[model samples]
Target: MSELKTIDARNTFCPGPLMELITYMKQASVGDTLELLSTDEGSAGDVPEWINKVGHDLISNEKIDGVWHVKVRKAK
Candidate 1:
């Protein structure tokens, strides 16, 4: 099973959640996973795009209880 790390960016706004994920990714080892929770709609797509652009794996991007849950795996 993949590890799940949740980054709470609710009410923070766009790019905030994404930036948090990026920061955490820098310290994570390859194969580690992060589950990002954000209220910012921009993260629905932006997060995954960042994962791809930076060579990470997006496990999923789903809505759970009105929050966007972005699942990512460290690929590099």
Candidate 2:
């Protein structure tokens, strides 16, 4: 199993969480899985859009206890 890079952006809003994800994604290797935790409602949509725009794969997105847990695989 591959290790997952975790980005805890809880309590952060919008671009903050998205920017953090992008920053980490840049450092992550291709095929690496990333887990993002965000409390921002916009991230539910923004993150996925950015992921697709950047050609990453979104594995899962679920909200648990008001936190959005998004898993993504780096494609490029």
Candidate 3:
């Protein structure tokens, strides 16, 4: 069974949150799920863009209480 991991990148800006997600993604197994939490508004769009560019599965992307939650599944 695939596992879900949370990567908190709250309070950080643009590339910071995206970079953190990429780092965790590298170490994640195929089919694993990663949920990224970020206070940066750009992450709502940026994270999903990156996920698509890299050929990953985007489970969901939403904002709650001013925080962005982007969920991705490792597809490669």
Candidate 4:
């Protein structure tokens, strides 16, 4: 499996995590995956929705305890 760059936004809010993800996206390659760790429940829906809107690939997601582990691939 390919190792992904991770951002731990467990204490952040909805748009915070998404913004960080987008900022990081700028430096990532087309196929590179970003693993976002957030505690905001809204992120489960918000991130994926934004990912689709921005043309990224939502590869997978999981919930561990209370944190959301989301994997997004940079497409553009």
TM-score of each: 0.87, 0.91, 0.93, 0.88
Model 3 residue 32 distance off true place after TM-score fit, in angstroms: 0.2
Q: Which scores higher on lDDT, 2 or 4? A: 2
User: Could you tell me the lDDT of residue 25 within candidate 2?
Assistant: 87
> What lDDT tens digits, residue by residue, belong to model 4 across residues 3-46?
58999888975558888888889988888999999888888998
Better of 1 and 4 by lDDT: 4
Model 1, stretches more than 4 Å misplaced?
none
Can you give the lDDT of residue 15 in candidate 1? 60
What residue pairs are clashing in model 1?
A: none
Model 3 segments more than 4 A misplaced = none
Clashes of 4: 0
- C-alpha RMSD (angstroms) for model 4: 2.3
For model 1, residues 30-69, the per-residue Cα lDDT tens digits are: 8888888898888898888888888888888999888998
Return the clash pairs for model 4, or none: none
Report the C-alpha lDDT of model 3 over 2-53, residue by residue, as the tens digit: 9999999998665589999999999999999999999987788878988999
